[model samples]
Target: MDKVKFGVLGCARVFERRMAPALKSAGNAVLHAVASRSLEKAQATAGKHGAAKAYGSYDALLADTDIEAVYIPLPNDQHAEWTVKALAAGKHVLCDKPLALSVSEAEWMAGAAAASGLRLMEGFMYRHHPQHKKVFEVLRSGAIGEPVHFRGIFTYPATADHAGIRWNPAQGGGAFLDVGVYPLNAARWLLESEPTEAKAIAITDPTSGVDSHTAALLAFPNNRTASLIGGFDQAFTSRYELVGREGSITVERAFQVGESGVRVLVRANNSDTEEAFFFEHTDQFQLEVEHFAACIRNSELSLEPGEDGVAQARAQALVLSSL
Candidate 1:
């Protein structure tokens, strides 16, 4: 099968720093084109990444018949609009996480993909990392008994000025929308269930009106629970724990494990020493792109898909409502 020809929809920092390089390395995909609001920037990005085509605007890239799939790393607010446009142009889509600011927008994006019979996946790159698979394997082996509780943390001290697009609510920037969704998705993934109830609290910055920190508790079925915290008001950490009846498991450097070794720790109830699982660094973004390409090329290949994105937005909406 031919590699999926991917057209990048924006010059987002994530693209330049991560996804562009990942797409270039993916065995099942090619970085065919790149577009930006500025043609000069687009040209520079294409030259830097060795993309074959560059367009002044996203619409131009979508209009290009050669691009078989599109990767959108746009601002949160722009995801739905560009996604629908790309699908309408008969291309599969892989949009960045927190798929949209609201569930309605996510549904619309999903609906467009269904109407066109195109593959649509949310770009939760970390899920493709091998460390997470190890976590699940440990759980299945009963190292962690019947899963009962989850604690997820993803936070960092903002090194940049506090006045960027992240501080703007209209741009769909906030602690929960940005990094908090990772824990939310992780809980749903590991628990294999959805929440029945939710509660949350957030500390909003006065000048920005965006929550600098958000903490939430979600109650899942069968007495399972997850407590999550995400923000720029704390030291850098990306980790999560799953506590079962007999023991607990912890994943270190969980979400941001780019090109670095990762660890998972397991502690039994009466253990003097804890067991450990280690994984060597791997490019999760390349794995994610390859998976998306496989999904595009065959109906049998599973995808994270649009409905998952919609559910993620729905859960985020619940947390926002509680705040």
Candidate 2:
């Protein structure tokens, strides 16, 4: 039972709170090292996470031969640049979501990974949850008849940190990149097809030049449709519902489940029957890391590789352009 040694490229908040523990706990992965531009921060995170080493710079961490994999939680704008660098350095990469700001950057990163013969994945941890698998299973069983429409919403109250990256346009801060990617990807996954057209409208925060709220209608192949909403200025809500010909399925915690059990509610028999399915607390982040690490060790384990991220980027770009 060998474990992949992981070097994390950033000490971002998500890394500190969730991914650090996940990388440490994953059965097939080890948090070997962490890096940040600030030596002090890197050292503190390493010590806290029980990582073996810390580096003052990303290059230093990438140069470490012992590190077999890299988890990148860098800013949205840096995902491509650092992922390419990590891949070029002969390391498998697990990058944060909205893999890149544009399709070009995502494609470039995918190309680098392909050329390097290294594994590359985007970190959409929610998709790794068994709850989603159950939903798919239910769909397959025809419990929902045929999924035709999806409505997703992910929002959190506006941030108070005006100077933070969430409001910083240069860092690729926007509702779509920050949270909308979930529903966009989910629509494709549940609908089982790429969207053919997108119509979107956004409420931009004039002060910050970042979209505070974005809503879109996606037209999928065969007349399947989806409505997605993402926002940084709204009541906290994270959920999605799929409406089918005969029934509907709703996931209460569609994303960002942090050690909490989630519920999947369903209505069937033409809305005359109702049932609920429960998935006990399972750390999706740990599952995500372990899956990727296992794929790195054994070629048999399938993965949502970098190409999927590129497709996601294409949809994202399309949504923005439509807006």
Candidate 3:
């Protein structure tokens, strides 16, 4: 396929503001269709995104033979069900983060994808950003010399609307499932190991019955450890610091690297000097879309494959259980 045709499974705000533009920017992909429960909304979104078709239901979009892949930005609880359905319909899937609410569901989705011989990937746009690659390169260069600890914070004030999906517990609303996964995934990626133990403390909202704030601790092998804070009712902050034997590295605005330049700060052991590494901004979502399209064209798995989603969900389940 010269260009992989994509069908968006929802007209969610994230799709309108981010993924739609990303699809337009991706070199090897096209925004071919969109679907929503409401036909008018679907048509409006399709018009805005330049999709050729719009459907009143997700099933209709899945049935469209022209759509070779589906980008699912549905609620966290809906990811596995729709991903399995899309795979059954012969469409590769790029599901938004928290690929499933549970490890079992993630494993089931992965199994379905494998059975259908289709590619399935979780949408972690930050991993595709050039800044993260730079960080990895710096780490590999021994600039941070054997990282021993990671501290990450991702938090933002929640809207007053208690009816919002993000604040609705029945719909899989919570801080941990939303933004907490980023820091946890970062810790695992940077350490190149899964956490051996995990624990978390959460503050549940009185009215919403969902966790409004959470702090988690993960212990990896080699005596390495990580502390992560995520909250839905807090001042806006997103950053991380990796401490090593020789030095430390800090990333500001870590999760949402937007289109502006970002900086990484490095400090050597016993040195007051802090060096800054700047990275020109790029569209990470576009890169993510292009990479998925490439994997589909080449008949290979994505860099963040379905199994990775399962691993993430497993760790998440462990933490949630502990909480």
Candidate 4:
């Protein structure tokens, strides 16, 4: 239990470029194995990531007695099935977001994790970033007054190629499921409350039948509200603003703060000057890995636990159902 040995469920690109490096950097975690449908791909990824083992199928990795946990970066549609299977195999799970395509799927995954007595966390790595902690600090400090409204924008232009997995409806591809979850999760996180009612408008691609652009409004308790815009057909932009009666805070490059520093702008009502907070660069993914490992060794769940994923999925379902 000194260090958690993790087997990757898929050799996805994100694992190769981000999560694997984070795992290696985590002091209390080790990349033990990698699995892919193709043995060669698994071997290549495992070797590149310095993993000790590789398997052709996910089942093989799950069966490895040495692997105490699994990191799942599979397709959005496959999250629930693999998470349940991994939990059934007696392994803690850190699955990518959105945790599942629907509320029922998320509930099933959460139930399996609870039944198995294992830690199951949705990989919303941004929550581990120091910048967000600073944002919360500012909000709690009352510098921005009482946060009454929030808005987030996450969008990027789609490629000319229409065959990408994100463009495939069968794969759970859509603006809301893919990127909208970020803003939704963020609003809930910062607001510290779940949305009670939701509404959305989405522009579906004629060819893919997947949402290319979506705008959603979520109504929280205490008369608080949040607005989010996610799109696969707009200029690259990721930002959010929290507006209060007396002031407001704005965050640029919100979701992918990465190793680059982050800045939060605060403007108080009736004040001519704006206050700015800057945070040093941090590898949020590494922090996330260490946190998951720590929770595993300590026999606990994450601060952002499985129930948060369920709430997020429920809110998302409400939005999608409205459309």
Candidate 5:
């Protein structure tokens, strides 16, 4: 099997903790380079991640002939710009979630990818995790019997770092763009449709000029509705529940890791019983990298395409706008 050589577009903290290791461990991918505005950071990331090259400029990474793919962990606002540039340069792109700051930007990205005939994917790694697949299978198997409603919550208290990107307005910092995206994405993926209508509320930080907390109600087809909550002013909590006519599917840790397994507790209406589905623990990041490599090797785009990212972004934007 030929390994897909990967060039990382930034030395973002997310890459150091998650994506870099995933690329290193994946059997079908190689971490070939990392680029950052700072040469020191780029060199450090390259050394730590076994990257063959380090470039001080993003453009330099794009120029590498050996790198067929680029993993973009840039800021939320920069996603579309870099992705369009990478696609135009004839390199496959795997951009971070909330693919762009706006629907129009995301549309432009999708267009660029189609025009270039290069693989373009938004990084919604959780959808590739086996546990999520199990959730889909159960839903498809009628275990839940017509999933009618979904409730998702993701929250983690933010540090008082005023300069952090999550608190910066120019870089697209807000709870809705950060943790909020997970619940929104989960709802969309499970329902497999775009949100038709939305209402939302937000608590804003006067100092930071960003929403510290946000809650939204999304109306989908089939008279279905989903409640999504994301915040930076709460204790760590991540969970989602899908309620149907027959039973309910509850995921304990909807978007994060745990020791044992994610519970898929199923309960029928009249029965005082529950069936638990146990899934083996695996690194979701590694699974994501493997899937990305598979898509590239097969000369295909990602399972979670740029459009999915765009849709999630649009939903998030609508929620924010409603707030």
Candidate 6:
């Protein structure tokens, strides 16, 4: 199969530090071009990342005939607009998560992709990691026996810059829309059910109008519920627990899978044991990029398709509305 040609939509920190390296590592993907509102930034990113072309405008990058796909790492609110434009430009898109602020916008993005016959995928890198797959496997093995309750938390200190994206409400910034989506989606994927109801509270930054902390509860059927805690004002913590009738499971550093090992503690029937699963040092970003490239090459939907993105967006909107 021919390598998929890729254009990057921005010179965001994520692009420079993460996606660009992942694209370089993908066996069947090429970083063909990049764009930024500033020509200098665009040129610098293209040069640093070996992109063949640079455009001062996103539309110019989308119009590149050689570019078969585009990765949009734009702000949350801009996801829908750029995704629609990229699809209309005849380029498949891999957009950053929380695809849009509302389900309506996500549906519009899905419609655009369908009408254009172009693939559109939400960028959920952790889902592609093998460690997460192991978690799914353990859950399916009945080790956790009929999950009853879940507790998930993802927290980190806020960025030092006041102008950072996470502090910009106009950019769709907030604890729930940002880190909170990870735990929310993880719960949805593990439970294999959509949340029937959501309640959330937020501690907002008065100056920025963005949330600094958020706590939410998602109610599922079978009298089950998931507690989600996320914020930008706390020390680093990424952990999850699944409590079942027979036993329980706890995962540390649940969101990031690394080379060292993944710790999974399983307790059942009054017995407790732990095991560490190790895998090759694979970059989640590379795995995600490879998945998108394969989908674009085959004209198929990616693992986390637009529908999943829309579902997550709906859940996010529900939480936001409650707050």
Q: Considering summed lDDT, which 10 consecutive residues are worst modelled in model 5?
A: 299-308
Backbone N/Cα/C clashes per model: 0, 0, 0, 0, 0, 0
Pull out the clashing pairs in model 1: none
What tens-digit string does per-residue lDDT give for candidate 3 at 55-123?
999999999999999999999889988999999999999999989898889999989988998888999
RMSD of every candidate to native, in Å, equals 1.4, 1.1, 1.4, 1.5, 1.5, 1.7
For model 1, the superposed segments whose C-alpha errors exceed 4 Å read 160-163
> 121-204 in candidate 4: lDDT tens per residue?
999888887777778877888877889999998899977456877888998998888888899999988898988988899999
Reference-based lDDT, residue 220, model 2? 90
List the lowest-lDDT window of 10 residues for candidate 2: 298-307
Error of 2 at 166 (Å): 1.2
Candidate 6 error regions (>4 Å): 299-306
Best by TM-score: 2
- Candidate 3 C-alpha error for residue 202, in Å: 0.6
Instruction: Give the per-residue lDDT digits (tens) of candidate 1, residues 1-323.
Output: 99999999988899999998898899999999999999999999999999999999999999999999999999888999999999999999999987888989989998898899899899889889988888888788886689999999999887544566677888888788888989988998899888878899999877788888999999999999999999978998899999998888899888899466888898876465788888998898999999899888888877853258888888888888887
Q: If both were scored by TM-score, which would come out higher, candidate 5 or candidate 6?
A: 5
User: Per-residue CA lDDT of candidate 6, range 1-323, in tens?
Assistant: 99999998988888898899999999989899999999999998899999999999999888889999999998988999999999999998898887888999999998998898788888878778776777778778887688998899988997745688878888888777788888888888778888889889899878888888899988988889999988888998888888888888777768765557566666765456655555566798998899888877775454553358778877887777877
lDDT of 2: 0.89
Query: How does each model score on lDDT?
Result: 0.88, 0.89, 0.88, 0.88, 0.85, 0.84
Q: After superposition, how far is residue 32 of candidate 5 from its true place, in Å?
A: 0.2
Which model is ahead, 2 or 5, in terms of lDDT? 2
> In candidate 2, how many clashes are counted?
0
True lDDT of residue 31, candidate 5: 95
What TM-score would each prediction reach against the true structure? 0.97, 0.97, 0.97, 0.96, 0.96, 0.94
Which ten residues in a row are the worst by lDDT in model 3? 298-307
The model with the greatest lDDT is 2
Which pairs of residues collide in candidate 6? none
